[model samples]
Target: MNQYLISIYQPDGPTPEPEILEPIMRDVEAVNAELREAGAWVFAGGLFPPSTSTVLRLKDSEVLTTDGPYVEGKEHLGGFTVIRAADLDEALAWGEKVARAITLPVEVRPLQHGACQ
Candidate 1:
């Protein structure tokens, strides 16, 4: 099985009201459950906002730490799921389920051999 990253991106802004977000969370959880049942789920998590991110880089032979995302964008990675699939088509099928659940864009990419081993 190949591992794939399913990235969930959300607009950079305030979170939606509970009334609008609660159902979406429920749907996402449902999809997660399905993945787990299929033994496809490796790991999944939701991230804090970009403001909570810290960028680290090597500069002038020194490590520099910068607050916020590495790059500013209208959308940022809000969450992700790592799954094991037979191939790209299988991974994309799972990605489609997540996108439908969250009503947002999802990016699916394969992991390199022995990655995270």
Candidate 2:
């Protein structure tokens, strides 16, 4: 099996009200359940807001630290999942489900090395 990273991006906008939010949350949970059942789920999680992020860089062997993300943007990574699949096609199929659940684009990319395969 190959491992892929599915990145979830969220736009900079107001949070959805619960009446509209609950169903989406359920959809995502259903997908997670499917992944778990398929043995594709390695791990996944929602992230804290970007403002809570810390950036670090290496300069002349010194560790430089800064607040916020490496790039400021209207959208940020809201969460991600690492899944194991037989191939890119399989990974992309999973990506489609996540996109529908999150109502956002999902980036699907293969891991260069597979430690869990």
Task: Please report, in order, the local distance difference test score of every candidate based on alpha carbons.
Answer: 0.97, 0.93
Q: Which stretches of candidate 1 lie over 4 Å from their true place?
A: none
Best by lDDT: 1
Full-model lDDT, candidate 1: 0.97
Alpha carbon lDDT at 75, candidate 2: 97
- Tens digits of lDDT, candidate 1, 30-65: 999999999999999999999999999999999999
How many Å off is the CA of 66 in candidate 2? 0.5
Q: Estimate the overall C-alpha local distance difference test score of candidate 2.
A: 0.93
Candidate 2 TM-score, C-alpha based: 0.94
lDDT of 2 at 60: 100
Which model scores highest in TM-score?
A: 1
Q: Any runs in candidate 2 off by more than 4 Å, and if so which? A: 115-117
